[model samples]
Target: MYETFDDTLLSRLNEPVPRYTSYPTAPVWESTTPEVYERHLSQIAKRSNPLSLYVHIPFCKTMCLFCGCSVILNRRPENEETYVNYLCKEIELVSAAIGGRAPICQLHFGGGTPTKLTQDQLERIFFKIVSAFPLDAHAEIAMEIDPRTVVEDEGAKLKLLKKLGFTRVSFGVQDTNAWVQEAIKRRQSLEVTQKTFRLAQSLEFQGINLDLIYGLPFQTVATFRETVHAILEMRPDRIALFSYAKIPWLKPHQKAIKEETLPSTHEKFGMYLAARKLLLGAGYVAIGMDHFALPGDELVEAFKAKTLRRNFQGYTVLPADDLIGLGITSIGSVGDGYFQNVKELSTYYQLLDEGKLATFRGKILSPDDLLRQWVIQRLMCDFAVDKAQFQLKFGTSFDGYFHQERERLKPLIDLGLVSVDPVSVRATALGILFIRNISACFDRYFHKKEGPRQFSKAI
Candidate 1:
């Protein structure tokens, strides 16, 4: 077993920590039926609040060996068209459930590669969403892009995306090292990434974010530093640095990588520290666990103003509200409850063909679930929890419910990972590195089933 926070922190951090993207994470989603999801929409309608929509496009041209996300590869073009058609149907079904259009404050497209679809597919999907919902005039629309697959015709695609109201783009650039790229089967060249950024700049997207990863196979501190320097040169509005999660059993394709080639736990920590130092020195502000943005970036500003929030898609400046997820394996949150779509493409398609919503599973937040979620979200986003705020929002004394958790965390406090006061529990600098473990103390599902260690490391 691990001992000592410094000696054991790195290993413990890597020991299947929840992303804390959602409390009682997706693994515990069990009652999200289609009817239940419709009820969630109805609840949102009654609340009459601006909503956030998340569209999951799970198709990709090729699978990166290191990827652990829900994605389908080597799919026919017709499969994409079929998925889009079903997505349109889902929009109509959700719109009808809400009675009329509800204002959307944010819309984000994430995927195996959201840009894998042709221009026409994107247009059809976005147009359908716009027609079915009342998108706020200042709403932020964003998409994730795979630079390797983007074409010269991207100019036209950008024009259409802008016209359709997309204001931000995040491109994946895990590592610039050719050997690391080859090991992960991502194979993206630095030149290609540069070209993509230049093209995006020409198109004048409101914001550009570069997604970089550390701890990939064959990634050294020197190589990663060079990659960061190159990225700084690009001057993206935001950057998200992620630690590579190596889980061969959960994601069997990861077995393609030779385990010996990966960086050691200590080495990975060094890489993280080095990259953070370089970025901070270059005038970027660290936001939450793994994101950084320039001083003027909305995310950085949000953090300073205490408006940062944690969501299914990592960190966001957008406020928490109803989140409607469309497409296979997507999850939605309406504040009142949570719902998830069918994971298997066949199941998703079958329901759509039958004119039925394709929800397969879900969970309604019991009061306990909601309380724990609030605690976890605060810890994840703010590195602390205000006891008074907890009581004010949940209408229950924090001491009454979490008295045992306070006892359980005594050891962490002794280890200097956290400091507890009369009003709040704050994570120390050391605790920030292991925030997930601290947050896990409040997770209802942590002890239910050990299951598979399929998630990413905390560091």
Candidate 2:
């Protein structure tokens, strides 16, 4: 959505950059062990704010070809029973660590595919969550669904979810183009997506979000235009428009996707502009960097009030002080610490079976980490940071502390992407497109450009 898709600017700015979902990002996490994560969890038990729970469901039947999530394509369907048992054990141990009867305000089930589980498997896992933690009066539960797998049975599944207290559902609709689908091996049809959307709307769902990716193989401005039009017709409550991060070395499945088929930086940028223009025209308010919502959606209201918060999950309406992550390969945050479960399946299971917290790695935020995180979050969500308010919180002059980074903004400043002064720092509409690149100026962890980085291109 910047001023003419400038190839020169793309070349200059496109480099390895974190999505800034977290300052210090995932690559920097270190020196954390199960004992350390457990310590954080125990400490969080005394905090007054309620909890937000992240449950990872890492099972899937097949590959999406373009997925970057931690998932396994389990052919042995019966293994879900064993997986559910282990999840319950983990939840019980974690809940006990939090002193049980802890309050849960938000619950999100994310995965390779949370919906891939059978109805009984889903119920069993849900039962464990409710039994372990007491939810608030209006506790929100959400899950990500794969539209390609939903059928008439999904109607019943949607109804079941509502009965079980889930208020939200997000469907993965990466692209609607047949050729794009073929190139990606997802093969989801527009008709299936329409049916899924209709089913969810007909139920008691409070919100529905459709996930779209901009830089997938075989995706052109022309073909993606039709995809955008088709998505707008569905009129989802929110849209998560993401730029595809091709990290083939990290996600080996992506290695098969030839670079020749992927769109150029300019084309990818143009596709993003086209999609944003269409969504804005259709009355969707841009929520944050990549999310758009209707005027009445909570995200839109939160954005206007400057209360939007970002976590490992994209954008959140709730400013949860603590997030407890359960299940294998999940990440958790408590206070200034972040923890992750064992990535390997067998090891994760063995740890829980031993009645131990399975945290394998983590990092405790430093003073600078927290400060830069605040700056990054503010600039990312609102495209601006109030100099006076920042000083009030951090007890430092914004200009003085960040002067070095401000100097680094010479190119962006010259290109009219951002404007800064003693009073305020703000991004022009064009600048928001380059927000990650601009925010990188303040990221202390990013400069090393160390060993074989896995971050995606900034464009």
Candidate 3:
């Protein structure tokens, strides 16, 4: 049914796409004042629901050329301390707004690099959080760490993190090839990563995740394969193999990377296919998009049972609830709406010092937005959506609302990339590789002008 792999398959994959982290993704959020954020928080507290907390640490010791996250580079340690104080003030304001401590089921620290915080600062910030929020005894606290920044003495710090109630840790390891490392300006050695891995293991952290990128400057199939093999040997509970999103025009730093040196679309696809085969052979189950987990891992089991969820942090087994984001540039999902803090440090500090919420922009989802979000989230996580559930939740037939998507998917169905029945729509194995494109059909906001070009590739 398909023609040449080049024009038909590979070319199809090259289309610019959204990651579908959210339906009306963060880009759609509009500027909101501190008053609106406080009102939003009050509305959430009234619901008496449990929430997840996402704290952003936007400082990095050095910039990685391939990185697309919002971060400040090479800031002094004093800058970190200043950031922490404002964060504490913001936390206090949120706590007061909530009326009291609300129970939390999940807490995650994502970066620039969360580990850049000194132990004392880490303790102070976390202490305020624990005091302000009622954390479940089985709550999961996770943080992303850069192996290069973590020292041997920080072993005790890892222990302290556990004692402070962190349950999971993730580290970034783009590629093991020295040439690739040199090009990206992130030169973490195997030794440093190994040490961090072993230290986490010794401390008995509940889960460990290793992140690897497939397409980078100077990376060959062989070098990528070696990185995959090394990761398999290390045996992390989870692995995320992401394709490098090369958007040089958007991220000016990336322009330093010669485009000619980057992998071709086909080459990058080959690397993904090869690494996937190796991971499968080693007994890792593919859990939704880009994530692989061992059979015993919770994510793998969740995938099989169809209980997995996809969030801003990628595929997760955690339950969906309100998520409160802290620190600069962090976004939070509370109830049916979303809010984000001020992204710049100066704005973040000024608002907090005045004892106000630092919210700059946010979106309160309309009923249509919520319905579309449900459909898109299901498509992303399960690779399928139940038509009956769509009707039940939205009081509208999926056929009536998404007639265009139905028409669009007809070609994919004919090509055996998807299966459509009255009750459900599912992505075939081939379709899964292009899930971003498939999911985009449900995105209403995606068509609004063109979104920012800084985003990585959909594949």
Candidate 4:
């Protein structure tokens, strides 16, 4: 069902590309102030669309060697308590800016490990947001769990979360192999992983997800196959098989990993293919580039219905018209603009103390940006672009407007990775594996002059 690849082809096609989580991408965002963000929120206040909220809990107990996200390592509970207080203040500032009591359809807690907070801290943040924004009756509440953090009182903690309206949770179990886990400095055993999964299942959470990484140090097809088989036994509602993005220049912590121990591109592809085959055989449907969901899952249904969306959090089924981000280093998208909070905790607290939002940088999408974002998001999510629909929406000829992009796609089409016709431009099953590169053709900001240091490889 897919094309075979030789080493030469694989090497040539393995160029770095943006994950396209955002259209213009974070690299192009310009410095801006809270004033600019407030202007955007003013515009949002006039619209009736429900908002999606993202809270970045940046505190973690320890550093995972392979992690590239923004996080702070603190052993003190007081630091977390202080951060939670500031988080609530920021929420109040944003709600006041939006004229108060904006409706919310989805709320996601992410970061270094949201569960790292004490139960009191967690409840405070949750109630503060719900009080500021009236949560819809059908809204989704979710968080990221670092299984080890909850191993002490797993059942009680999970039950507490469920009681507080947490319907979905994702556990970070990067790999189950002992050697690989040791190499990554995350040493949870298969038994612990299984116990955590069973605990969430027994808690009757509506959705449970596990995260896995391929191409890490010392991974082989046989080894990853064993991990995948072990994961299959749990049968989570969703699985995220991410490629190990080794950009040491961007994240210096990654340099701790030995280069020679990491799998080569060809070997990495082998591991991915083996794992994907097993997932498909076990009745999972691939959603977007790195996510897979069971057939009846909302993600699979969204993919089938062409309503799937991609955000900074990766693939998602709930597409909110506006997303409001709170806490340090959080990013938000309102209308045609995107904004981010200050990355430093001190600065975040200083701004909140001044009764201001901590927006540090942002980008207001130009008309060209909006159009290109639409095309790029469609290709990333649906794996195809309907030429007729583009014309209808943008009032232009897709062929004429994207002449250069279509030319850029010619080589991929010739290799049977892409197919184009008068009606639509689509990626074949083989092309889906390289969807990031395919979608990159439409990105106006991605340039050879800028270099590819900012992004990871498509594979």
Q: TM-score winner among the candidates?
A: 4
All candidates: TM-score: 0.95, 0.97, 0.95, 0.98
Q: lDDT for model 2, on a 0 to 1 scale?
A: 0.86
Model 2 lDDT, residue 365, Cα: 95
lDDT by residue for model 2 (111-227), tens: 988887887889999998888888887887899999865665857777778888898999999999999999898888899999999988988599999999999999999999899
* Candidate structures ordered by TM-score, highest first: 4, 2, 3, 1
Which tens-of-lDDT digit does each residue in 15-78 have in candidate 3?
A: 7777877657877778888898888788878665567888888889888999888889856888
- Candidate 3, residue 190: Cα displacement in angstroms equals 0.9
> How many pairs collide in each candidate, listed in order?
3, 0, 0, 0
Cα misplacement distance, residue 18 of candidate 3 (Å): 1.0
Worst 10 residues of 4 by lDDT: 444-453
Rank order (by lDDT, best first): 4, 2, 1, 3
lDDT of 4 by residue, 354-386 (tens): 988999998899988899999989999999999
Clashes of 3: 0
